[model samples]
Target: MLRVASVLSFFAGLVAVTIWIATALVEHAVERDASRRSLEWAEFAVWHVPRIDDLAQGLPSDPAELAAFEDLAHFGGVFRFKIFSPDGVLRFVSDDPGSVGSSLGTHNEHAVAVLTSGEAMTFVKDGREKPDRPDLYSETYLPVYDGDRLVAIAETYMDQTTKVAAVRTEYAIVGAALAGMILLALLIPSGSLWVMFRRLRRTNAELEEAQVRAQASDKSKSEFISTVSHELRTPLTSIKGALAMLESGKFAELDGSAKRLLEMALKNAEVLHLLVDDLLDFGKLATGGLEIRPCATDIAGLVQDEVDRIDSYDADRQVECRYTGERGPLFAHADPARIAQVVRNLLSNALKFSPVGGKVFVSVRERCGAIRVEVKDFGCGIPPCDQERIFEKFTQIDSSNTRQHSGAGLGLAISKEIVEAHDGRIGVTSAPGRGSAFYIDLPFCEGAAEAGAVELRNVA
Candidate 1:
C-alpha cells in the first residue's frame, strides 16, 4: 500500500507541475500579444494625424469645409479636433456645430505638447467630469504640420481599461486553478493510500491470528497420534508373538483350518506393521527428520535392482523391466538407497495396475542440465484429474471397494518427498485404459558441463 501510494503521488505531482508551467507560459504569451497590438494601434493613430490637418488647411475656410468637418466629427464618436490658422486663429471647431470662428492658445499640456514639438503624444484621461461620456480611456494626440509649420492637432480617445482588466482577471484565475490542482494532486492519492494501508493492516492481523490457531491445532494432533501409536504397538507385538508360536506348533499340531487361520493372522500382523512404519516415515518427513546422503550413484543400476525386487514378488503376471539409452553408468546426485526405494514404489504401483505379462520400462538419460529417469508401464492409467492428486498421502486412483490392489497409500507421497529433498521434481502422466509414466529429474552434481555438452545436440 505504501508503495502504491508513493507511485501515485509522484505521478500526480508531476502532472500538477506540468499544468502549472503550461498555464504560466500561455498567460505570458497572451500578455505579449496584447501589448504588441496596443502599441501598433497607438503608432497608427499618431502617424495619421498629419493627413487630417493638411485637408483642413488646403480647402476653403467657408461653410463647405465647416460642414464637412462637422459631418466627420459626428461620424467619429469621442474624437475632437482643433484647426488653427498661421496667426493662431481657430479656423474650425469640431465639438461646436454653430461656432465657426474662435481663437485658441496653449492652455492645456496635451495640446501644447503636440503644437510645440510637432509630435504625437499619448496620455490617459478620466471621464468623471463628463457624466454623459464613458470613463477610463486613453488618448493619442497627433500634431498636423504644413511644411515646417504646425497647422492643427488631432486627438483620438479609445476605451481600453476593460482589456487590461480582463488580462489581470485571467492571470488571477490561472493562479487559483494552479493552487486547486496542486491540492487535489496531493490530497486524493494520499487519502486513498491511507485507506488502503488501514485495510491491509487489518488483513495482516487476521492472518497472524489464523497462524496461531493452526499451530495449536497441529500440536494437539501430533500429541494424540504419538500417544495412540504407543498404545497400539504393545498389543501388536503380543499378537505377532502368539501367532508365530502357533505357526511353529509350540503348543500342538494344527489342522488345515487352524494352520490357515494362523497364516491369516500373521499376514494381517505384517500389514499392520507396514502401516505403522508408513505413519512413522510420514511423521519424520513432515518434521524434517528424514535425512539423505547424496553421491554419484549409478541411477540405472539402482533402478534395475528395484526392478529385480519387484520380480521376486510372486504374481501370475510377468512384469518385464527394460533399460534404454546409454547403458554406461548414468550417475546422478542422489541417495542410492532412497532412489531405489522411489523406484520400487513406482514399479509396485505399475505392477498392481498392469495386466498379465505387461511390460515396465525404465530409462535414464542426462539432458537439459539434469539427469532424467523415467519409469513407464503399460497398465491401467490414472485419470487425468487424479494424476496430480495421486502424489498426496492416502489418495488412491482406484477407490472402488473391490479394487484389486491394497496398500497404506503412502508410497508415492514418501517417494515425492525423498526426490524433492535431492533438489529434484517428480511427476506423472497418464490416461485412462492406456498407460502411466512416472518420472524424476535430478540435477547432476559433477561433470554437468561435459554431460550437457554431449547431450546438447541429442534431441529426445
Candidate 2:
C-alpha cells in the first residue's frame, strides 16, 4: 500500500509540472503572436492616418483620413487611437473628438520615448482601471517619422479578450489530452503490479500448502517403516534361530549336499535379518528417535573385530583382510555397537566388490586429535558422481534387475547415521575402476583405557 501511494504521488507531481510548463510556454507563444499582430495593425493604421507633420501642426480636417481612422477604431477591435505632438500635447483622438488638443503632460513616458527615439512600444492596460472597457487591451505606441525628422506619436489600443479566450480554449484541449495520457501511463504499470502481486500471493499460498503435505507424507512414511520392521523382526528372528540350530550339528547326519544347502539358507537368512535391522535403524534416524550410547572404547580393537568377521564371512570367495597402521590401542568416546556396525558395513562392501583372492586393507590411526579408521579395497571402484549419493537410503550403483549384488542398499545409509549419532563423520573416496577407500573419523578420547577395562583383548 505504501508503495502504491508513493508511485501515485510521483506521477501526480510529474503531470502537474508537465502541465504547468506546457501551459506557460503556450501562453507565452500566444501572447507574443497577439502582441506582434497588434503592433502590425497599429503600424498600418499610423501609415494610413494623416501625416505626423500634419498632426504636429494641427489635427487633419480631411474627411477621408478621419473616416479611415474612425473605421479602424470602431470595427477592427481597436478600442482607441490618439496622436501626441512632440511636446506631449494630444493632437488627435479617434474615439473622442472632445479630447483633442489636450495636454497629456510632459512626463508621459510612452509618448516621450516614441518622440525622442522614434521607436515603437507596446503594452497592456489593467482591465479593472477602465470601467467603460472592462476587457484588457494591448496598446501600441508608434512614432510617425517624416523622413528622419521627428513629427508625432500614434498610439493604438487593440482589444485582446478574444485572442486570450482562444488561447485559453487551446490550453483546455491540450490539458485534457495530456491528462488522459498521464492517467494511462499511471494505470498500465499499476495494473501490471497489481497482477504480479496477486500471483506472488497465490504462489506463496501454494508453497505453504505443499510444505504441509510433504511433512505429513514424511511422517506417514516413517511410521510405515517402523511398523513393518517390527513385524518382520519376529519372523526373521525365528528363521535365524532355526537355521543356527541346524548348523549347530543338530543335522550332523545329513548328507554333504544337504548340509551345504542348509549353510546357504543360513547365509541368506542372516542377510535378510541385517536388512530388517537396517530398515528399523533408518526409520528411527528419520524420526529423530535413534539414540547413541557413547562410552570409552578401543577404536583399533573395534576395526580389527569387524575386519575379522567380514573376512570369515567371505572366506569361501578366497577374499583376505589385512590390518595395518597403528597397532597400539587408539581410544575414542563412541558407542561401541554403532561404531562396530559402521566398520562391518564398510568391510562387507569392500569384500563384496573385491574379486577372488583380493585383499581388503583395514587401517586405524590417530591424527589431528581424532581416531581415523579406513577400509580400502582394490575392486571396481565407484564412479565419482555415484560416490556421494551411494549413502542415500535405498540407492545403489547397480540398481538394474540383473545386477550381481543383493539386499535393499540401506547398509551405508544406516552406517552413516550411526557414525554421525556418535559425533563422527564417514565418507568414501573413489574413482571408477581404480579402487575405493571408506574412512571414519571420530574425536579421540584421552586416558580412555585407564577409565574403562578393555572390552575385548584379542579382536582377532
* Cα deviation of 339, candidate 2, in Å: 4.4
lDDT tens digits by residue: candidate 1, 31-110: 45433443454344335433445443444445665565655433323345455443333445567635533343324455
Q: Which candidate is the best by lDDT?
A: 2
In Å, residue 114's CA in model 2 sits off its true spot by 16
Looking at candidate 1, what is the lDDT of residue 16?
89
- Write the residue-wise lDDT of candidate 2 on 50-148 in tens digits: 554665556546776667667767545667777677665667777764452335323367878777676667665558676667476677777666556
Ten residues in sequence with the least summed lDDT for candidate 1: 99-108
Quote the lDDT for 435 in model 2.
Answer: 85
Off by over 4 Å in 1: 1-48, 51-168, 174-208, 215-252, 311-330, 356-374, 399-404, 443-460
